[model samples]
Target chain A: MTPDAEQTGGIIEVRGLKTQFGDFVVHDGLDLTVREGEILGVVGGSGTGKSVLMRAIIGLKRPSAGEVTVFGQNFYEAGGEARLAIERRWGVLFQGGALFSSLTVAQNVMAPIREHLNVEGDLARDIAALKISMVGLAAEAGAKLPSELSGGMRKRAGLARALALDPELVFLDEPTAGLDPIGAARFDDLIVNLKESLGLTVFMVTHDLDTLHAACDRVAVLAEKRVIACGPLDEVRRADHPWIQEYFAGPRGRAALAAKAS
Target chain B: MADSPAYFDIDLDNGVLKLNAGGDWRARFLKAIDSRLRDFADDSVGRDLIIDMSKVEYLDTAGAMVLQRTFHACEQRSAASKFVGANEAQRSLLEQVEHHLAPCFVAPSRPNAFVAMLDRLGAGVSEAYFVAIAILSFIGEILVAIPRVLTRPARVRWTSTFHHMEEAGVDAMPIVGLMSFLIGAVIAFMGAKILQLFNAEILTVQLVGISVLREFGVLLAAILIAGRSGSAFTAQIGSMKIREEIDALRVLGLDPIEVLVLPRVFALVIMLPVLAFMSSMLGIIGGLIVAWTAMDIPPALFVSQFEEAIAMSNFWVGLIKAPFFAFVIAVIGCFQGMEVEGSAESLGQRTTLSVVQSLFLVILIDAFFAMFFLEIDF
Candidate 1:
């Protein structure tokens, strides 16, 4: 499907967004749109401002100048209740599954529910348990603290927590950073499955080539403080950006090419 | 100019031995009189003996003992085997055993121990101050949390706070209880020893009661909590930062300060007074043991004396300090945790800083309270 063709409406639209930290211009005159029910993969090298772009989109860091409209609301200019209301519609899965060490897996998932929904006691517990199970964790894993969890399990728990409110949009940052190859593939599969089943739009920041190949609907290559190229996998690969050329020409890139060829 | 072997020079002037120069040595032994005597015939007594220990940097146990014996032998023979050109390390070794060779050999100018102590103390003071600043920043975070608490009531998840408090306060009880009990026992033991000398042993009950209620009990409890829960705060926040959980919270339209910080600060502020109360009572019970056994006081009289000495004012003073101290500890822990950069090393460093800062602030606040009470008539 074409990037914009399947969208009911734009879930997130950024126009002329500019963000700077003092003398450093992290993002300058950046414009993008994340359509409804599309996985938009943001790909870049370490300091190319991909994560910065995500931060700006999520309203964690305010833009220096420009407009970010989420669900037709002016996100950057919004205040108080308006901002929170916009935020509640989105979920985020961070890099390493930042589960609270002091909290059991169940309680970690329950945190957003209790905070946003004011659901409590047995009902909250049930919802937490259900979320844990949905992420492939056993019911008994719900009572276990973050410290007791394996690396893969913690990432799953993080995903479950992100999905707690059943948000329409999800932002994932390097979800497969330290995971083994198999684990990374499984997580990528989970992300794909979740998006397909839930009709959720995804904004993912990643360096993982596999995740880009396996999951992303459209890949946006960030370079020189803005999107250098953005489109389907084959189009982005054929682009002439030097970083993009080198990245997709590497060993992993060839493997992805071979997989697609087959 | 004659065919004589060169000797390392030995100079002893005004009870100070000075060695001007020496080359690095491989091995040189200072032979003792006993061993030398055992090796030599009596006819060799008239031969002049010199110890060439200038080449010896390290002395073994046997080598050192041999030197001692040789010195004694020289005294007996009315001639000294002078050790010349000994380096600083050799001189220190000689000085360590100076008692054995008093009046026979003069010591070199030793570096002032007081000066060394002062230098170390200076470094330690700077570290302590840095720790104090880290702690103050932590307290600043709690103050920061207060405004967030008031402003973001929707974000202050009370259930999470209660969950944390249950872990921090309730789970910590057994250890706190045991420590207080031991402290109480030690206090009673020490008081009994002093009171017995004055034959005022009956007053031991009042002494423990007042001390435990007013100062030691609360201070000890705060210190323990600082080490335990304060470190917990840092580790939790640090780990979250590492994992990007805090970022996740923000992404999910949650204020990390409101969701993570507010609840923790509130829970700590509320539970500290309760923990302090528990600690005070446990300490008194410890003191009660001493009163019953050592002082020959009945349990009834001990109870009455304790009741009379510890007023509501004393309890309030400690209780008031608890929330403040708890606030300080929690803030320090969370702030340091949040401030952590780099790897696991940063987390460990911040955790240590958190505990130390919390303890320092607790003591500082306690002193301020003491001064405040002293200034007032009450």
Candidate 2:
């Protein structure tokens, strides 16, 4: 799997990954590669650790044994400016939106921009505004606190913040989990549109089958502490595995595929 | 990877300003690109501006955004502009940004100072009114429920009541005992020092006996409990409210006041009087210790002086106020918790308010009690 994942144009490579919590092991010998400018969706049964792999790559969780290379630099070994520089090139949208409850939506978006770049004040504000609008929120929503927004709007606001610095890569964790069907579909459209417009290489951990059908260029299936299948959704769907079989051919999965066809 | 520093070249040719932009125009390199583009925007006023991106090696949304903003500024200054020589990716980036340019954002206006002050004053007044109404209603609910439970005898939650009692009374014994002892000792020490001037050092026993039995014991216990158990009650109930457990109780056809507030109220009402009596005894013993150690009076002599100075009425007066103080502290804490809203911040704010209000009201009621006792001369 690592040999397959170690291809050219890979923006992120996770090799020989193992994640454990105290005595419980979450992942072992997991391998994944997110190609440049592709939306890679990672799916798994609950407790199979789709998010642990994302956390391992993003430097939030220290893997017990692994090397995560981001832009070809070993993420754990990088220090100071090198770490900051890599961080400057990517953004993460957490499951809860995780907006600073104290700041307005616009200020939350402007935060990363002001942190990493030097620019005129008005321009910085307008850039934040542009991002908020691009995510399909109203201009008035910019002044809102995160607690004031509904669940769907909060996720969109989080996405706007993720895109504020115009990073080459983005990580989304359960972006559509709580959204209504229409909101989730619109969110899928939004992410795909942003990827097309911004050429972002995305690593998404999600449970929504619709998101996978609509937004993902490739799908990776996690089971038994490793990726059991990884390729384009169709190719991955054809994998002769139990979880993949129940997932893509399951009733809800078939509904997702039908919706995509329609 | 080293980013090639982006640069721009501007030249006005035949009423057409040709701006040449080059190098890696990524997010980190856009600050310089934006400033130079701004300078070009002013020079190209009322002229056709052509931004040539053929020389640019790399481009991202940050760069495309700055360029799009420059186009917008140029349009505002009444200049016609067309972007040229951008490859498919860069063109798409610019188009996407240009198409979704946000509606003009006007920063929210600040309220006038006088208006803001009036607003706050009105809010505070209404809040105080609501709080008064809430406290009365909650007290009424408890009063109504008390008789209903008392009639059944088996309806009371004995376990919860005893738990609160243990937490608020039994657990608090050491601190209450120590505090009263120290207070009583200090009162006697001061009394002896001041009375020494009048050759009335023997009056120190009377001073400690009357003061500790009548006021300080009850007051100290009430304040300490208000700060400790009162705040804990608010935090507990407020967190339950935040987690929607209060609603869960209501959904199951149980009154929150009956389930959550009544046990705590009963525990405090039952325990405070006993604690106050114990505290009074400890305070007297502290006074006795100080009198014996400092003034060469024996414990038997101090007890004889204390028996003469302290009337049973002083002990009753102190013990009587305990139940009232306890009731207020418990009611205020539980009521503030029931008022909790969505966030953890709300839980925190309500907890602080519960403690402060409990302390304030306990002291306020004590003052009224003081005047009442003074009028009756008990």
Candidate 3:
């Protein structure tokens, strides 16, 4: 698609992405589009390559064949500078809150800001503090290392770091995976709140159904080496795919819908 | 579809000042908008302000912040301010930022340099003291565990001991043999040169025999083992420490010292002597070969000279130190391994420290034995 035609185009466009590990195919001719200013939740079973899809989009894994476009620029075909320009517009929060164990929380948040912006030391530290507090953490949490923080706080710190550079888009992998129900709900609310306030387009890979209902604007289901369905929660829930039917009509799914209704 | 860069046009009609925002107002274009907004604010203060955002092709937090800051500044100056022409999404975001954006905090002040230095000094001393105590306690625990392990042979982890023995001793033999042989050859060459200047080149046989039996053989073997096996021990134990495997062992009502450390130490104690004796024989063979080739000394003459130059006590002197060197190397390696803290960086530092500490102590103990042997004329 031409740049002129993409005025209302997707912020992220993955077209015919094929990824394989040796003989095992993860994604074959998978296509996905994440529109501007929307929370897109990606779901799949245990080994359906949800994480693999995200990795390919984020350039952590090289696709055997595909094109990933960000901001209407083809990331896979772009040169180094062009790729970097596109990369600067997005940030990722990995599963397990991959915070730098060696640096304090504040320093971790400051890392991207210092790398991308010409902000001064004192100003960068201030920005880090603001981001930390924005994630609903105490100011004192900034001084502690990742190991010193609880699991939830570590995840919050990771989110703060992902938001450090004021990215237009953010990718989160299983943001609520290990948290308790209340903690997961709080995390979902934080994502929603941050998305609205920051005007961010989020591409999140998740297993939590409540996150889809509570936070996501749309849900994309990955199965059989492709995105089987992609749309709003209700629309995608009505997909005829067996896995999709088993997933949305399952006991856990019913419970999640009931919780959301309440 | 619009690919236009974001811009704003200001208009003042009567007492109301209206601003029309357009283009992509994201992070990439924030710098230009920031200055422009501030300039617009300075001129339009105390005037009722309206920002029309419907024309914006894109509006992210960077853009929202620019509008919100100007709005707040006008409100502070008693200028009635409100946003118009914003779509539902833009309106909601603007409202969210307006309500929830946290104020940036001031940076903390640095500590006084003098006080900071003193603090670091105090911390270093205390940390060192703590490590010393931990190592001492570990040694004591190993001593206590040894008898317990010996008494209940069934309680012994025979498999792990054999595995460690293979890793630390058997696997290390070729390198140890090769290294000792080279050292022996080098020593023979050096002795030959010095004694030849004095027309006493035959004495090279004595030098090679005595040193290989009493010093170079055991020293070379110990140093090699310390570098090789010591680092392996630290890395293995350190990773286990990081993964809470040690805690798991304790939870199962087992002593880590008895189960993990004693087997390793015992293996080293048994193998170090075997390795040292082998090294000594190889060193002697190497010296014999060098003597025969370089000095025109026949094999018979070299053998007779070597036998005459060294006593059984000379062999005892070298062999006696092997067990001590092994003990020091094994203990330090396991101690450092167990001392590893949470991170991979600590594991690497501990491994490096283990090799250095073991090598230093081994050489120091060798020096003491050297002095003791000299005093007794061994």
Candidate 4:
């Protein structure tokens, strides 16, 4: 298929998605649309399949039934070349920073670039170094292996790799998990900064209220196997769902709100 | 004005050159773009330039950088050039490139293959030296602590020692017995065949008795233990190290050597000799059966021939080697376990190294003991 020259609306469109494992259902008839160049925050209770939804859209997990489209192409029905073309345009940051354990941070960032591009080795390394710094990591951090860095640094390394291809869209799964509050806030800042600078349409799965309040342009809450509420934070905050009520009106939510207001 | 089949279409009217660049301007098309850029650069010399980029469906870093280079080239050629038709997102990305383009270091070239091989060889030698030093220090620590624990017998971890004995000795009986029995039978069969050539078939019992009691029984049992329990020791301790459980022990002011290593080594030392003696007994039984069936030598005559031909000193020589082999195997296994680094890959590597190193050292020590005992006429 040719590039979608007339495409100008949603970057990702998921409709009637149903995913199940044995007798357990993860998502039931879920629908979501991610507008181009906006950070969409996905929040859910534990085991509500936030990560599963991210995996499904990224083509890592095949949904039991769904019409998943990206950039006006049927993602689940596209041919291998078309799929690869779509895959090349998007990047994913897995939950555990999933940076390959053996490769240095620079090499990790270069992996996708090398896979998708025809750049020389020197050019690739230079691009990787730029990405590492763009994610707020030092140039020296590029030479170190994933195991040599702290948890926050590993997350940054993963971010650099996600941005390696200069992808139009990025999927981040709990990017701020396992970090201190200050570190998490710093990471939130980095995400917003990169999104504006790189024109990335970010689909982020997170449980951190502070991240949704601080960074995300829109908040989508997953409950009862589908998105119960989705809109601007102010609109989603007034959601009548019990989970949303307890989540945003709870002490942690109140603290996050106060922090955001400040 | 319309969709074009080509990646780049240029229309030049008079001294004004308009270049239309569109489609997926990503990394995969860099080679094609390189030629196109060269043509654009050559044709646009001294001509006013206008680049239409709005129709570009995608533009990544490679595309932006190449476009930036072309823009610079036009400036160098004294041609006034302007970029037009970039949408909000494309403009933002180009602005990002413009702002964040800082000088970066190129990755250093890798060493040649021969230099890499030499580098690995050097690293291997240093690794071996460090391992030898670590093992020696470990042995010295255990030796020093043994006297203190021996005097205060109540302080020894008796329960852990017995637990390990069950794991290493009692649990290993079936395989050890089977292995030794098969070896003994094979030796008898070979010996009987050769002896029959000289009409000395009865001598097969003596051959089986001497070899089983003096070497094969202890050697086979030690090698099996090295493959079995040695790997387990490394895996258990290496996982503990990975999980920082060893650090937890240290933080609690407890010596991991005393708690972990001592019990495992003590258990191996105590059980190996017993296992060896059992293997020797089973081996003799196997040889007795083979001699009776294969050579018409009854159990009665075989026992009498065995009693007359093999001395108790042969048994002592094999038994004496058991504890030392056990010590070496245990120490090497535990030392490799302690050397495990942060990754699961390190744990797996160290486990394999533990088994291989222990088996090699066991055989090497056996060879040394064999020569020493031969010199002394034992």
**Worst ten in a row by lDDT for model 2 chain B:** B71-80
Local distance difference test, each candidate: 0.73, 0.87, 0.85, 0.85
Q: Which stretches of candidate 3 lie over 4 Å from their true place?
A: A1-9, A238-246, A249-251, B1-110
Give per-residue CA lDDT, model 1, range B167-230, as digits (tens).
7888878888888878987898898899889988877887788788888777888888888888
Cα displacement (angstroms), candidate 3, residue B156, comes to: 2.2
Q: Runs in model 1 with CA error above 4 Å?
A: A1-9, A260-262, B1-378
How would you encode candidate 2's per-residue C-alpha lDDT over B92-166 as one tens digit per residue? 888888866664343455699999999999999999998899889989998999998889878888899999999
- Chain A TM-score, prediction 3: 0.95
Ranking by TM-score: 2, 3, 4, 1
TM-score of 2: 0.92
* Candidate 1: tens digits of C-alpha lDDT, residues A99-197: 876788888988987788666654455456555755677766777777777888998999989987668899998888888989988889888977865
Q: Each model's TM-score, in the order given?
A: 0.44, 0.92, 0.84, 0.82
| Higher-scoring candidate on TM-score, 3 or 4 | 3
**DockQ (C-alpha) of model 4?**
0.31
Which CAPRI tier for candidate 3? acceptable
Q: What digit string (tens of lDDT, one per residue) describes model 4 on residues B1-378? A: 553322777887576677788877665666555766866777666566777897788777666766655665554344447778988867766666654445343333579999999999999999889888888999999998888888999878999999999999999999999999989999999999999999999889889999999999999999999999999999988999999999999999988898889999999999999999989888888898889888889999999988898889999999999999899888888888888998999999999999999999999999999999989998
* Fnat value of model 3: 0.13
Error of 3 at A35 (Å): 3.0
